[model samples]
Target: MTGLRIIFMGTPEFACPTLRTLIERGENVVAVVTQPDRPKGRGQQTLPPPVKVLAEQHGITVLQPVKVRLPESIEQIRALEPDLIVVVAFGQILPKALLDIPKHGCINVHASLLPRYRGAAPLNWCIINGETETGVTTMMMDVGLDTGDMLLKSATPIDPDEDTQSLHDRMSQLGAELLAQTLDRLVAGELTPEKQDDALTCYAPMMKKEDGLIDWTRSAQDINNQVRGMTPWPGAFSFLDDKLLKVYKVQTASGAGNPGEVVAAGRDGIEVACGEGSLLIRELQLEGKKRMSAGDFLAGYKVPAGALLGKKDGAVGA
Candidate 1:
């Protein structure tokens, strides 16, 4: 319903597109609920979510609740009397009370085809697990995490080197499109929500900084996926010459040697050994150095052939 009163719930950059799309389509967004600002970045500076900033720019009422369970927050939402509540990467587990506030109930724009990859960080896990195809789903929200009934789903193929950041950007736009179409069908009483088969559910737990450490013993492809999937935050790292060396980009290779051994070094990429396969590092950065090509790193530092990457009692590169 283009003119339907809606409450949009989201927090990250991925969610911003859906919120923007609703406003652009002239939907009656009564309020926007997002997570509270938290300290972020190297300096731990407090930062508001992109969605919050965008909402403020549009003069939309913004609510940053540390927790939505509080009575006043509940009352505030009830006051709006919204027809539907839309959630997208809201970064919080919504309570049952809030899920039932909207007359048509709350719906979520999830990044994966539901019943598979049903948890936080679906986009990253999909590539990490080598899935060739993934997509977006609009679902009826339940108390369980992403275990909702699917209203509409749209699929897309994943490129061999597609990372989480790029995939997220694409899904954000796709989710907005799906939500719009889902809403149209819903208003026309043509929407059919299919219950997700719980037996087929897979989880995508949140990624942690420790998860980015490179495990050289793993397959070259797995390490490569981890490196790219964790990019731009909690980057995959390995110890080089007793110092932390972060790997920003990498590719699989055919060579093999002792796991973590530097097989070759050049401007193209740094070839490193794995248990069964090997990986060529394209980009890297030393602990206190600017990001540069792996070849540049090779030129400055002696990461010569046969040098081991990770040592015991040393930091493990994810």
Candidate 2:
């Protein structure tokens, strides 16, 4: 509620909560800076980013810069005279020119506890790596990647069945709450910055579509994590008879056979043997078909016992 000249920068749905919180708390948000609208989905229709839509609804100025480091973009930000810059999942790096223009510098709402998951796609990587706990961090932005002093943090435990989409929703709201508290404490001058230990750093690189390919050679538990970690994005997947079969949910089971071999198939699920154990496929999407339960899939499609499943590449499973 202070008279700080705040400028919000973000693009995806993950950043919406923090912006909404600032607006609700009566922050003087002068403008919203987000990436340029781009084509998305099957239609390839160009649409405004969620942040831009939210900002427009609130009657805040929206800025879509192709490159935030451009001289014109830097001058545009400098013209705003922002006392503080708040960045969530903005997708663009703020150059030194724009960072220096803000009176209070820049504060970032990172999706992980730095310096643990300090790169892009932290949420997905945490689950993919089988991390039992993770959280959000508000850091004072710097030239380096999430290497700034941490202002505040909020942690949450990862559930056994948690996926990226579910965890993303929860963490988004949590981040908003934490950022509100951080801003209040900053205004009251009651906050002390904490330095992150670089030795604990682990990078979560940007994900690619191919990253979702399932390798049956791994343990059942590891493959299960990979399925959930990539959910609603690239999607963990394998091949059945040279066709793509996307896997959404799975449960570890006890079995012994060659990795990727279909040891059992029935109403409960299709039990496929893994390198160590096996996995019961609960949900999946086969090529030229809709996502369905294992039972429904079994009713029409046949995943016969002793059948192989894995990458399309020529291999034992293939």
Candidate 3:
């Protein structure tokens, strides 16, 4: 357990906690391998990845290779003679050469309970699909994508009011703690790696901006999930008076009207009918405007009853 020469590979905020935990627990982290700094934000200024920033703070050597599978990249890592390569959200895939370089091979801390949810945006998809439970999984990496053998898993319930941002923060902490336990069990030879069943696997591809387009034909509950899952990113949106309207918070309501029709628009909330049930819009943002409560929006804008929302392209029935 002690003196385990670990080479950490990761990027983004999610990976920071794991790398920090490993260092805090007295692990001998020799070097940090992360994605290269790239231009970010409105100014297009280049910025270091979160992992690289954390590594630099602790004086750990940081490696940022454009192509991690290259011969030079492989050699650079091999020179470190790492006992274990701990990977978490490290954009690039590791070649077989790098995987074999580490004494104990490589291990990944993923944000899902494999093989159920596997891929780039598991946490987002879980909430979008209305899943009641999800968790983190630590696996021994292999050639296949997230098809690695599972070492340990820790489950947690998905709160009804939880948004993608909140769930992501929670899962990151959980993954860090779970990873610490996994490393300890691995060093003690008490860990049992189980092969992931491809039959139960589900792919969660990277989210697209268009994925937030609200379809009133869908059930109210489904649309509510979309609002929760897409928050703070490609936010859930619908067309209102031919302008983009982003939905921040909503709840199921009882009403009967054509899908997308505004059953009632008042200070209480905007009750919009769906293919099944209805939705009470509690919070939203109009095009080129700041987010506001339904009551404030109603007072300023006149969204009278029976107005068809999503009528931009005549998608909703008249």
Candidate 4:
């Protein structure tokens, strides 16, 4: 433990927590590697990765390699001579050459229970698929995508009303805690990596902006799942007069009518008909407008009774 020199690789806020946790516990993080600063936000300002900022604040050496697989970047990390490399949401795949450089090998703190949710956006997919339980896993690095030997894991129950934003915060902290404990065992040589069962593997594909489109032909439950899954990012939306109408909050309704019809509207909310049931839209935001309650949207807009509430049938890009 006394001579353990660590190199930490991470990018986002999710990774910041783990880096801070390691530093607070007095670990020797010899270097920090994160993605390079990139244009972000509406103004397109160049912003540093969250992990990079934290590392600089603590006086840790920061490396932002644009192409991690390049020979130069691999050589830089190899020269560090780290005892272990800790990665959390590092935003890049590691090559075997870099993985072999560390004395104890690399460890990844993944937000999902592997072999399930193996891709980039695991937490969002878990909520989208309506999973009641999900957890964190620390695994030994491998060349395959999140296909690594499990070192440690712990589960937490998902609440019925939990959305991606809430669940992500919880999982982020949980991953930090689990990762710290895993490093403790590694220092003591008390941990053993276990191979994952490929037969039970599931994948969580990265989300696209077009994936947020709401189809009235899906069940209210599925629609609700999408709304929760996409919240705070790539929001679930429908079309109204060929404009995108982002749906922020909604609940399943008991009543049913023709799909895509606004069956009722009042202070309670706007109940829109779905394929199998209905959705009580509690919160929404129309394009070029501020987010407002469904009741407020109805108050300002002229939505005639029995009028269809989505893009015209067969209209492209609706």
lDDT of candidate 1 over 1-318, digit per residue (tens): 467789999999999999989988889998899999999978999999999999999999999888888888888898999989999999888888888888899989999998899998888888888889999999999999998789999999988887887888899999999999999988898988899898998999998888887888889988988887787666788887778888888889999898888898888888999977999999989889999997777787776798888844543344
lDDT of 2 by residue, 1-318 (tens): 978999999999999999999999999999999999999999999999999999999999999999999999999999999999999999977778888998788999999988899988999999999999999999999888889999999999999999999999999999999999999999899889999999999999999999998888889999999999999898988989999999998999999799999999999999988988999999999999999999999999988999988877735331
Q: How do the predictions measure up, each by TM-score?
A: 0.96, 0.98, 0.96, 0.96
Return the lDDT, model 3, position 133: 98
Candidate achieving the largest lDDT: 2
lDDT of each: 0.88, 0.93, 0.91, 0.88
lDDT minimum window of 10 residues, candidate 3: 309-318
Q: By TM-score, rank the candidates, best first.
A: 2, 1, 4, 3
Q: Cα lDDT for residue 16, model 2? A: 100
Clashes of each: 6, 0, 0, 0
lDDT by residue for model 3 over 1-318, one digit each (tens)? Answer: 457899999999999999999889989999999999999988999999999999999999999999999999999999999999999999988888888998898999999999988889998899999999999999999888899999999999999989999999999999999999998898888999999889999999889988888888889999999999999787888888888888999999878799999999888799999999999999999898889999998888999898878846957632
Candidate 2: Cα lDDT at 309:
87
Model 2 residue 222 CA deviation in Å? 0.5
- After superposition, the stretches of candidate 4 with alpha carbons farther than 4 Å from their true spots are 1-3, 312-318
How much is the lDDT of residue 146 in candidate 3? 92
Candidate 4, position 246, lDDT: 92
Q: Where does model 3 exceed 4 Å of error?
A: none
Model 2: residue 135 alpha-carbon error in angstroms: 0.4
Tens-digit per-residue lDDT, 206-312, candidate 4: 88887888888778888899889999788888877767789999999977888888788888887888888998889998888899998888889866646566654
